[model samples]
Target: MSDSDEKPEHQKENGEINGEEEIRLKPFQPWYSVQIKGASKNGEVVMFQITTVKLEQCKEEVEVDRQYEDFEWLQHCLNIVPNVKGVIFPPLPDRPIVSAAEAEAKSRKQLGTASKNIKGDEFHKDCRKLEKYLQGIVRHEAIGKCEALSNFLTKKEPPVRAKLKKGILSNLSRAVDGVRKGGHKDIDEMFQKERDLANDMQKIAKETSLNFDTMVNSLCRISMACNHLSTALCLGMSAEDNGASAIINKLQVEFAKSIDHYGYAVDVCTANDENTLGFHLDLYSRYWLSCKEMLFERTCALVQFDNASKTLEKAKPLKKPMAEAAKEDAEKELNAISEVAKKEITKFHQQRTLDFQKSLILYAEAKVKAARDVYALLAKDVSTIKQMDVEFD
Candidate 1:
């Protein structure tokens, strides 16, 4: 992870691309790995254990304490320009959602009632997602170099979250603006095709995410049911004290052991799907929407330029100068928006391919491991059952 000018997405020294248009890369690409080691609760706030895994600026590891709000502050402070638009801002990982039982468990620890420290599944999962969010943005050429990021990593004090209120007037103005900028006839076929693909990809990602979520939930229920069955199998032990009862008890114990192991395999499958396929699916769904918003900003720029052109045509002789200036300003803004959108869109596609490939590979590996685990558990139980001594009539 070097903060070098050379990035994989950059074009070659020859500057000639294969028939397609060449994209100019930013002069610097900051690369670093960040991790959320664990978390600590301070009153109502949860502080994350932030560790810098690799970076040139900080040759030694830098560890700091931060919270979810601190991350939100960093993300919102990310400025590609004075006004941030047409850039694909990485989405924040969703806030951790815990059930009532998990909440009570955490509360006990916070209140110094619990004897041991233990984290829920959601805690581990959220930390991983947050890690990805930090790593994703910090590797981007423009965003990664932000002073805000450096301060977040190196500084001991957490960032103060900026308060931006959304009032009714602001919401109304935004909706009106969206309507004003909604439709524009794109003259370029490349961009038109890209926009169409984005629309389709967003829908597909959302559907796939929902399906995986349903699948994981079903697996969890099955695991719980099997666990209950495993426990019930042990209840027959105290019924009677006879040879037949003893034999029945042995069989029940073996069966219970097998069922319990199978439940673990089911639990493994749920974790695998959630971390790999399910997590990425939901992530991509958000990013696809983000990219679409970038294009929409470009479209908004187009609309402004078009409106300014029309206004210039209708202006009186004395007002013509002001109108012409407006057109020039609009044109400049449009060109800038187009460049930013192009850069971000190109980055999005490349990153999407890499992410999907990695997710699929990990998902396949998890499946194999889960299957092998269940096989070992069941086979062991079968062997034990065969060796049991039982008297028959």
Candidate 2:
């Protein structure tokens, strides 16, 4: 059809004057728009623009009708809306969260371990100190016995004095030999030897009123001191090693029971989250709990050892007198016996004390190593938890 024939009646008046039809355009509306400055995995930035919708709803519903044909190279400048609320990312595995109960259990284990170690260390130290004190007592007793024998020899009349002196010397020699052998079967035997040496000295001291009285008094004093020291040392040793060990063992047993409780808690938490996560959280909880239990047990052992040592220290001073008395009559036959007993006690203390100290030192070293290992594992677990949180966020 011809252009004139197609013209409507509205333009008929202008048709004779070569009239043309006019087109109408709508008014632009102000709208909220976001200019994205950065690109996210799931969302993109809009360089510039205004739209007639809320940014919140526009992200999901806004549409672009105009094509940028003239500015083809600027296509990247056009703002695009994302369908999702946040940046799109790959799904991550759900990480197990450490629960309050699990944390508490672990802490308890760690605390127990630390306490045990401290106790053990203290016990060992005390034991060593006791041993040292006992050794001193033994040496003092030996010296006293020698002096007592010399005094007895001086008091005796020529032939008798010589015979008594030889007897005293022979006894002293035997006592010394016994000590050097370090093979006494019983503590009583050792004490009996000391008593014998004291009696010999007392006998000689009784021969002359003035000198004998003085010697008797000295022998009594030394004997009393040695007896007191021995008693104290024995008490201390028993308390430190035996008593402390018993207490630690009990505590450790309790700690082990706690582990079972922790395990149960973990199992519950794991079951609760198992369906959602695809893996068992109880496994991690149980593993960590096991570590804590081990640490607790070791600590208990350490404490027991420490307590034992402390007990020994407490006993050391108590037995000082007995040790001293044994030394005073070292020269007397009876004094020689006391010296032998004192020496044996001292030797026992030294060996045991040394052993305790060594054990504590080794335990501390192992504890530190284990702690470090645990820390590394905990760090890894925590990192995994963080990553999971980020994914959800």
Candidate 3:
């Protein structure tokens, strides 16, 4: 072949770099492997250190610090709110809780009393939740492949959150949204039932999470009481070198050690349950809320379609072209959303089953593991006492 007619060596099978017969790259929806390395808060705003890579390209890893607001912006860009696209956006993680101990420390610092840091491991859980949220958004086929997602993952600068609509516009939007959500009669019985079920499940799941948290707190108090008992026993022990008094002191010290171990075990095990079971329950509540919103979006489309059909009928006799065109657009939008929602609902149910099953199994395994941990801690302490040189001098 002539040199001018020949393709470049590098572009041979890789496709033409530049020519009339240029390479037509096949389209691909890239999956991102995302992780939240850490999270930190500045006042009310929390920023996450996120690292992500496009698994398909094996491109250079992109690490960026993103505020929670940035994530909200990403969702907004994907048409999550107003959800006119019939997409169920992944819910953001709940904000960190300021425990009573931490709050008291804050109060002390505010009043200028010397206070030490007493923050719990809430950051760890928050990081996990945020990571999962990112993963969910990226895993979705309907919305994940957007260029906005790429910018969110790779951009060093934060995305600008749009200002909330206020005054008349806000009121008008809310009124319209409310009518759309409530005005339409549900034609699909399955969807109606699913909506009610999802709402009920969300409520129960949230309450269950609170109950678990309360139980964990109560167990924590019990653990503290055990520690106090151990300390009291230790302090009450006699210092005499030999005789019955000495034997009694030894017994008190040994028992006190065992009590201390028990207290530690309770702290460890209950905390595990709190993180495993309680965390997932709270997560479910948020997910259900998003799922419900998706259904509402579909209903909104249905309401629009219903109104358009009425308008088209009125216009037909009058020969109004604009009204007929508007009606056609509405019908197209409604049909698109309906088809999308059918797939979405089925996927939602399937995912829900897998998630709940995994979470429940983990909770059960945690319970079993906690029980064993307590036994081991207490047993090890008691064994030390058993092997103690007990013969009187």
Q: Where in model 2 is the C-alpha error above 4 Å?
A: 1-336, 389-393
What is the per-residue lDDT of model 2 for residues 252-310, given as tens digits with 9 covering 90 to 100? 43433333333333333322222222111222222223222222222233334444445
Worst 10 residues of 1 by lDDT: 110-119
Candidate with more favorable, higher lDDT: 1 or 2? 1
Model 3, 1-393: lDDT tens digits are 777666576567455445434434433355788999998777766678999997877567889998766776787777843334766678877555545666666444432354343435467777888888888888887667777888899888877777644599888986788665754677788777877777788788778877877677667667767877999998897777688778778888889988987888788777777667777777778888888777787778777777887887777556678888888888888778777777777888798788878878888897798789878877887887888777775
Q: For candidate 1, what is the TM-score?
A: 0.83
The digit string of per-residue lDDT tens for model 1 on 154-202 reads 7888777777566999999877876776556776677777777887898
Each prediction's total of clashing residue pairs, residues at least 3 apart in sequence or on different chains, is 0, 44, 0
Count residue pairs with overlapping backbones in model 3: 0
State which candidate has the highest TM-score. 1
Q: Could you give the candidate ranking by TM-score, starting with the highest?
A: 1, 3, 2
Model 3, residue 298: distance off in Å is 1.3
Clashes of 2: 44
Candidate 1: where is the Cα deviation over 4 Å? 1-27, 98-121, 167-176
**TM-score, per-candidate, Cα-based:** 0.83, 0.18, 0.78
